[model samples]
Target: MFASEVLRSVDNMASKRSNTFKVLLASLAVAALGYVLRSPSLYLRRETKSSLGYPKDSLLNFTELTAEYGYLSEEHKVLTDDGYILTMFRIVKARNCHRAKRSPPVLLMHGLLQSSDSWIDSGPDAGLAYLISDACYDLWLGNVRGNYYSRGHVRLDPDKDPAYWKFYIEEIGIYDVPAMIDYVLNYTGFQKLNYIGFSQGTGTFLVMCSEKPGYCDKVKLVISLAPASRQMHTQSKIFRTVTQTFYRMEGLLSMTGLQEVFSKGGFSQEFVAFFCQLSGVTERLCEKVIDAFDHVDSTHLGSITNQTTRVLFGHFPAGTSVHNMARYGQSMNSGRFEKFDYGREQNLVLYGSEEPPQYNLSATTVPVMCIYGKNDGLVDTRDVEWLMAQLPNVLEMVKVEDPQWNHMDVTYSQYTGDTIFPKINEYLLKYTSA
Candidate 1:
């Protein structure tokens, strides 16, 4: 063949290759832009909203409700060793009831994405803060780091710094729990405080006991309500989807400044509140949406006043680390309660192991009473039993008698005060002088 003919053929092939490379680059650019545009927080705004049925006597925040209820409440700013500034609230006593100044202190820690408001959103009639105060226990509510109330940090601003988002349940268990516990014990002048935790609250406490067993000595009797660990058997498909699919987007989302999950005043929460209050068809479906994730006890649903549901959800899923959600997902996949997975190579560097270390449940030596519902989907019965077996000193396991008593109902249900609190009160009474 002629040299020119051969050169011409080579040039044509080079031209074709150039065009293909250009197309590939353009496609990648479009895909990156698409991911940026699809911000996770805004994904839920694709709906027409009418009303939220916001309470006529809506309370603004935990402190606001404390004043409205005439309860004595104080807010404390605790600085974690890891540079997170967490907010914790305390209810000294019930204003309506006369209690001795020396009332025993009880610290109630809320679950994942929840804040101090969880204790009071049910109103004075049934709220745990009020009932505890009325029961003569100096009640305190703790907001874990990354929630709405505890979003501040000593060195990092959550809104502006990506580094601020570099934590999960492990950091919370190790840093936030111990800091808050020490703060509460110091402030209350108590040798040890009675402790109660719900969901992630229970998980963090258990983590604290394992990572820092000394804290367990400061807790008199730990009550775990709907304890969340090893979510292997979680019934909520959405929860599992989030732990799996949605969590996979965290790196991309955070790169676009969407690190905070379920951001307040964001589209997702607004859409939920608005859609949940529609008159007939949508309303029932919305209620079922909640029931599907938690249990659907009609009696409890009936007791959940419009104001309660409206106010409670407004503060919930408040915010947390993307890593936190991802870790929970890993737990579901691995069927073991363990530390966050930072890939295999990174895990070796960070943890000196190929896989993340399982939380040392055996190190949790506190006298623990686990209260779980048969219908609780988040913490399956089998998972709770596994948690019980792992704990070194689980005193008892109380299964909620009401077959339909799902997770949230343990705190927000209509009969929570009657059915659950009595048992809790009895336990507290038994250990009151301890």
Candidate 2:
């Protein structure tokens, strides 16, 4: 009888241990969920006020001025092929003035992670938008889908939906640029418009020509600044690795509806702050990364503005998706503009069930002028030379002699008005009455 009682006690002990294990696991799960929920808020609070790069007020000022330059008196909107409503801001150089009839309109496309605000920063000086406007050329700035402005769609919400994020630079070329071109031409009542693109802005134009052949006909002239068509020479090892990893996980994340997790303001803003603190040492590291990623000379780290650096990290670097970065890595690895590999060389089946198309420069019949800084770390001079050779309708290829002018100098450098703007103005004036 005593032995029987001992066996019952043993069974009772086993049952209690099992219940305790279950409770521990449940508590762990709840803790993990709480961490996930609070992480974004913590990151946002830390990054929003961090002064690792430039002051927030200065960046905000720049954003405001850029918006002012693009504001149109009339309500301007366009619909993307995917049924997304894109908001466009316009500024007419001439109102009730005869000069508007003669001068061709210039459409300025900002690079990745940049909005229309990137074009202007309020100081004693003027931005490219104002300079072109002052030169009596009608300047219109464009904002891409993911930036601060132009975030809207019929079936997607960038803030709450993963479908909105299911795109990269390729989509911009295939849908965004073409739609903007069509809208601009239709609204202006012009047969063709002048095109100017910086960095990824120029890359998308190449994509448009590759994916859709008829697009170049709508453009009368094209000017590319720090243009990046091939990334084989790019130097950022971290960027390449991250992109490769992101591509591998894209499918899993999309399935889990966690694709929009990065879009959360808390997460994104915190990332910005973290990088800003790293900017002190990492800025130099960033220059090297950009140089290596673009196959430029890493030895030459030129002067970059604190504001420009902040914009790069807070606004540009973290803003792009892993899918986009993977495509860039593929482009760099192949030295060609092509679709991203979805693993096992299955891009053909995954991205459209066909081999990604190559950008065809011969189809771009527009008058194009390629401009580059001699010391640019992103778009190497050799790549630009090769790209120029591919184009059939080149108007002029101008290389700036300034050795200090790096990739961002075209937009942010103090000497832009004194050195670069004059050259651009001279070119536009040839086709404009002013």
Candidate 3:
């Protein structure tokens, strides 16, 4: 009898080891395929570079690019309570425009795996940051903790410290957003500041209000462009697949200490940037690659110009922790906008319950204007309706008038000046005394 019990235990252990090995192998293949996709050099011909002109903007950082466009730019650093050192950018006004009247401060936060660059990447005419500044609003851009611009900590090394990469959207809401809010208001001496968040940026602001209810009093209004929280009905199968791959491999990744993904200045990101520098056919193909990730149809590609596409690759796929990706996966699967789930055992310890807590959307009392694309691949209208129903104060819900507008179009679309910015400006004017 004792021998039989020992044999059963041995078999269980062997089965567990075999399962772990299989999971690791499959996860590695998925990771390698992603890297290969970004590595355009492996598949493309050398002649493609013949006519390609290198984008000078690729080499320019946020402040440099702003200055190049004749905008007065300033950089400010804010240290989070938990030791993250984030860099925030400000466009005080156009260098050429001299308005004696002081503009009210309005903070613009970028989405996941993006930095301050997204707002200005499309140049002065269409870029949200430039337009807001041109309108005499004090424009401030906020970068989350782990992206390209804000990769610093008081003690831990990003490259060496696995602990440094352990944060997700929850931490951004509870720590990063509040820190930026306090800094911008303190420096500008404003009682409140307007906020504009794109994609995950919207999620972070919602999380902030949900987690720290008092912070809602500090915002005059929130302009949510392509707002996303739960992606349960997202149309982008590719994005869902990638998120699931990371979610399933979390245990193995935690064990191996592999935490960050698509880091800025990494080989994959740089190669994608180089490939995008090639003009004509190659650039068009690169746009298709972006389209697939965005889950937009081919017809939707008309909204973004070739130059905008090239400039976009220069700084995008910025970087985020693996845990952050997994958090999205959790929401996608469970169809709930909630805190990070740490498995049944760890969740009990951290949350005092087997299930993670759902964000209290009712606590978000700030007047919000939600602008979403009908064809957005990452956020479905159903989810947006669900979110609206939960919120106590939704000032407006404006779907992009353009039928082809998708997730990327919210920031990079050439038609935003005609399609969306007017409404944004109108909403801001209503809330501002200036």
- Alpha-carbon shift of residue 185 in model 1 (angstroms): 1.2
**Which one wins on lDDT?**
3
**Order the candidates by TM-score, highest first — what do you get?**
3, 1, 2
Q: What TM-score do all the candidates reach, one by one?
A: 0.84, 0.74, 0.88
Better of 1 and 3 by lDDT: 3
Better of 1 and 3 by TM-score: 3
User: Which structure among the candidates has the greatest TM-score?
Assistant: 3
lDDT for position 178 in model 2: 92
lDDT of 3 at 301: 42
In the range 263-285, model 1's lDDT, one tens digit per residue, is 55555565555544534433444
CA lDDT of every candidate: 0.72, 0.60, 0.78
Worst 10 residues of 3 by lDDT: 1-10
> Model 1: residues >4 Å from true position, as ranges?
1-53, 57-59, 101-103, 278-283, 296-303
Root-mean-square deviation of every model: 12.9, 13.6, 9.9
Scored against the true structure, residue 284 in model 3 reaches a CA lDDT of 53
Per-residue C-alpha lDDT of model 2 across residues 1-434, encoded as one tens digit per residue? 22222222223333345554344324323332331221344544334454444545334433343444452323367789987676666655322234443456788888755665556542225357666665667667777666545667887776677667677888988898999889888877887778889988898898888788788888777888878787666543433444444555667756665543233244434444344435354343344333433323445444445445555444442244445655665666666655665554575567655566566767666777878877665567777877778878888888987765666667656567776788777767665554
Give per-residue lDDT, candidate 2, residue 402: 74
Can you give the lDDT of residue 266 in candidate 3?
Answer: 64
